[model samples]
Target: MRVFTVAEAKAMIPEVRERADVIIRLRANLAELSLTLNTTGESPAGGGVAEMKALEAHLGEAIGWFNGHGIEVKGIAPLLIDFPAVLDGEDVRLCWLEGDERLAWYHRTELGFAGRRRLA
Candidate 1:
């Protein structure tokens, strides 16, 4: 696991937000495709097998980008991500979720997002 310092995590906030935006858009597109596919058995957006696969592929690639960077992806529905980090000698995760403008939250690894607190 790559353990990041707060500075390190914060440094990547812009890139993270950009990627999150792309993932968010792709997810929306995929969901729309799924809804259409399930509703009338066809997609008005020309979403045949190829179109669906392309959307899936793009989504996979976007999410995989984080994995490749050693960041943990906790959720896709709201795009929660965590950077493994140790603060004050204790292990924790520096967390970011979709719609957050900055990297300013964290929680102990065991507590998850429910235990999130504002970064001091």
Candidate 2:
């Protein structure tokens, strides 16, 4: 898995949201794929690494396509992407808490999710 610094993950939102609709669809599909393949209780059909690679490929494609359209992407950490982003200019980790409706958790790069504070 690839861990990304908070800075890296935030820079990609423009491109990511440019193709946000597509990304949402892909995420759903990927989740289904995971469920199906993970049913064996071992790992996905190709294993965890392969599954992560596939997601990376998909996200990379989306980012590339969007970037081609003039959307600049930065701060996109697949390994650590945990929730919807608010896109302020701070280097904060995006995460979803157990009960938040949308992504309402964030932490400084040095702190990480475990150190996330509420967004109120």
RMSD of each: 0.9, 9.2
User: Per-candidate TM vs. native?
Assistant: 0.96, 0.33
Per-residue CA lDDT of model 2 for 1-120, tens digit only, reads 234444554455443444565666666667766776667544545566577568768967865664464333333432223433333665554653322334445766566666778655
- Please give the distance, in angstroms, between residue 48's alpha carbon in candidate 2 and its true position after superposition: 20
Best of the candidates, lDDT? 1
What's model 2's lDDT at 82? Answer: 45
Q: Pairing residues by index, what is the TM-score of model 2?
A: 0.33
Model 1, span 82-112: residue lDDT tens: 9999999999999999999999999999999
lDDT of each: 0.94, 0.53
Determine which window of 10 residues in candidate 2 has minimal summed lDDT.
71-80
